[model samples]
Target: MKKLTLVSLLALFMAGCAKNTTDSPTMVGADRDEHGCIPSAGYQWCANTNRCERPWELAEVEGFDNTPQLFEAFCTGQ
Candidate 1:
């Protein structure tokens, strides 16, 4: 009985860690690339000049010289 209870608890924890596709919003605008998702703290895509920009592309536009820094900025919005 103890073993069964432990197994069930582990299963529940794993299930909770799984991603919920239904909870994620559909990707929109030109920013979408092969990744199928945009970078943002609140899942918000970057919009400039009334158009959505991909995170990588936006980083270049914002004058980030290094790819790592650009990626960090894109994800953190700093």
Candidate 2:
């Protein structure tokens, strides 16, 4: 019975050590959108700039409110 328990525990430990190759941690920029906007890095598609940009940063630079509506308005050149 002890041998069986020991073998079971060892099997579980080895199984835990055996991880799936594809189950690794996600790399940065892996969540980029179709326009290459990395949402994880706070980037979104900006039509006016024709590229990905962080809304808050764009608001600060372009003198617009940092709200989602304003971001959309500004990016759409409203």
Candidate 1 residues lying further than 4 Å off, grouped into runs, are 23-78
lDDT of model 1, residue 61:
74
Writing each residue's lDDT as its tens digit, candidate 1 over 1-78 gives 999999999999999999777755655533433444444422233323234455456666776664655655655557
Question: Which pairs clash in the backbone of model 1?
Answer: none
Candidate 2 lDDT score relative to the true structure: 0.92
Model 2 residue 28 lDDT score: 76
RMSD of 1: 10.2
Off by over 4 Å in 2: 21-25
lDDT scores in order: 0.56, 0.92
* RMSD, candidate 2, Å: 2.5
